[model samples]
Target chain A: MTENEINHIFQTWLKQHKALLFKIVRSYAFNEEDRDDLFQEIAIQVWRSVTSFKQQSAVTTWLYRVALNTAIKWTAKERKHQDRHESIDVSQHIIESHQPPDDRLAWLYEEIAQLNEVDRSLTLLLLDGFSYKEMSKILGISESNVGVKINRIKKHLTTKSEKS
Target chain B: MEFKEMKKIWDTQNDEALYVINEDALHRRIKAKKMGTKSRTSFSEVLLIASNLCAGGVVIISHLLKNSGNVAALTMGAMMMFVGVYILFLRWQRIKRDQQTDVSILGDLENAIENINYRIKLSQSMIWFCLIVIALTMFTVLNSDQSVFNIVLISAFFIVGFIMSRWEHKRFNLGKKKQLLDLKEKLINEFEM
Candidate 1:
């Protein structure tokens, strides 16, 4: 396909599925500016890879794969220099900017941020209503492992929510 | 907070659906992206280019400022240029590999693995090669008045470079290469399935 055609199709798909992109961003990033940066990064990756996307799988499947991979790599790079820049108070600006109107969704993200990296990703896929098989495919894990990990995360979150 | 209740809550949320793409911002982003890829040479690649330029400069300077018949200076400059050219050739191959548009997951995985391997090899070799050229060039340029201080400084540079390169080699293997290897193996298993 030509570049314009590819751009048109991607814009259409992104219009419908932007929530998926935002959901991944919100889950991976702590604050609003970070979310914006992650959103931009994911958008660029998708745009760059759009031509390479064959319809062998669902569009959502391909998207989650890219989103998860980018998030993992981006967060890894961020963590590498976290120590050097940890003294500055970044969270103050974040706090001023990120007052989510919805408390439940905020709490949900808080819970997600508490999970380990792999579990955090699995939870995002689970919350997006992916099947165990699809989660396995996206994550390169066994189907049974996805089931086991998701169940553990669910139970842990449920217990925490109940206690609180 | 059961899974079903969580799913219901997730499905009910419309607050997040409020975000819409602004065409102007997207156009700007796309333009910025085009610019980024056009100049996507990493810091190391920039260093390689700079080193090549410096080597070429040394050859010109040797002929103009120093004794035109100084064979050692000429030979060292020539050898440095060869090293620079070889390193640039390796870097170009890496850049080409990075730009390949392979859509399949397996293809992407293999490309990532190869890129990591290329990085490991490049880091391990470039440091020693550059160090040798730098030491030789320094000695040739300052050979007229070789003070004890100059010799000590040159020896110190080599020692520091050796230690840092050794540290980098270990760190790359333990961290980046190991992670990529695990991911590559998992990807192969995934594709096999």
Candidate 2:
């Protein structure tokens, strides 16, 4: 497709499924500004790769791949930025504007946030109803490995939630 | 609750689970992004290019002075320009690496680790060459009987640059490389777990 046509398609899909992007961003970023930065970063990435979106998988799958990868790299870079003394105190900037109204969902996301980065990605994908095959595709792991990891993550979460 | 029940709750979570996205702001961001890519330069690249310009200016000034021993000054300035260009090229490669998306988390982490490795290697490897250039430039300036003010300024630059480079190597390069490696190991270990 032409560049404009591809961008148009991407923007349309982005508008329709923005909540998917939101979930990924929220899982990764700690605050509202960070969330906005991550969302823009993901959007820019999607636009850059839109022309290469050969439709090999669903558009949502392609976006999930982009969003997760961007968030992973972005978080790494933010750590580097902090080390360089160039980062803001994101803790102080937490405005509480984006908190969920539901207590369980909030607690659930808190648990997800406590996960290691790789597990966090796995859990987010699992919660979004991705199949083992799909999660494996996005994570570059075997489907069996995806199943094992998800089981472990579920057990961990169950233990944590039970204690709380 | 069972995993299935939790999945149902997750699926049925309210829109409040997500932050409100402003469509107009998003559109504006997209437009700005399109404009920003034309002649795209990262922040690091801008700093590098600015230093290159300063080096280029030194080269022109030294060449125009036309002293008998100005050859060394000209040569050092030229070397600075070359190093600047080379570093900019490397920075461009790194910027491309940073832009890589649509990959798996393993791929992303691996790329991040590699990016840091490249930076550490570049800084570690360039120290001697930089010292040589600075020393030669100072030598030429002193040998040409330049003003004491200029001589002191060049000495200050040499001292600061050398110390900063050494400090960076000692303080950041080793620690940052180790940290990135540890992070990479943690990522791999998590996947295996």
Candidate 3:
């Protein structure tokens, strides 16, 4: 497709499914700056790959795959220097359960933040209601692994909720 | 948490402030294409300098040899030509490598660090090569009977060039490492949060 047509399709998709993108970014980025950076990166990657998008899978599936992979690589690289700084500030940003505003969502994110990288991604996809097969494709893990990881994450969340 | 509960929370969440993609800014970016243009200019400048230096060296050496019938000037010209060819070939290879991959913005940032590291390595090698060649030429020209003053001058030049090149190499590596670390940290924070 022409660049304009590709861009038009992307804009429409973005308008429709922006929340999913934002949700992934919000789960992965530390702050607004990082989120914006990832968003731009994701947009650029989507644009680059649009030419090769053969419609073998749903567009949403392709988007999630790109988003998750980009976010994972980005986070892995960022962890090298900011570990000390991140640990100190993480608690402050932890979502407080009783708050009525964004804090509640922050709480959920805080909980997500506590998960290991792989589990965190699996949980995010699961929360988005992707089936195990789709999650496997996006994550490059086996379907059984997705099932196993999701079950464990669910149990862990339940335990955390009970204590809360 | 259940999907229903999560969806409810998601629904209630406030809309994030919309990011205004300034058309003018994007237009400027398209026009400027700073990195692409800068890289192109740098490659071109290096090529021009190398070509001119090599050609000038050869012409001067030939003229000097023709005037004085000295083989030493001819040898210096040949050496300069070799270095120039090497530099040209290196630059061409680098440009080719850069063209092989297409990356997004973040990938570009990531690749920028790698490119910096690559440049550092190249600079370090070039510096060492230049130093070695300069030293060899001075030693061959001066021989054991060479004046102390000439030897000292040559030594000084080599030492200064060596020092500057080493400093640049270290600085480039340090900057690249810091950038990679920052990118790593940002990614981790996002994932953890």
lDDT of each: 0.69, 0.72, 0.62
lDDT value, candidate 1, whole model:
0.69
lDDT of 1 by residue, A74-126 (tens): 66554454223323333322112322346776778788888755678888888
Any runs in candidate 2 off by more than 4 Å, and if so which? A1-14, A25-57, A70-100, A103-107, A110-114, A155-164, B13-18, B23-71, B77-102, B164-179
Question: Model 1, B2-97: lDDT tens per residue?
Answer: 777776666654345635555565566556555645432355656766776697667868576856776666767677677678877887888787
| Clash pairs, model 1 backbone | none
Ranking by DockQ: 2, 1, 3
Instruction: Give one digit per residue, the lDDT tens place, for model 3 in A48-163.
Output: 56765668788878787777766766676554433233212222221112324376677778888887655677777777778998776665546776687777788887677667
DockQ of candidate 1 is 0.20
- Residue B82 displacement in candidate 2 (angstroms): 5.0
Q: What is the overall TM-score of model 2 with all chains considered together?
A: 0.69
Better candidate by lDDT, 2 or 3: 2
- When 1 and 2 are scored with lDDT, the better candidate is 2
DockQ for all candidate structures vs. native = 0.20, 0.37, 0.11
Model 1 TM: 0.62
Cα miss at B119, model 1 (Å)?
4.1
On lDDT, the candidate that comes out on top is 2
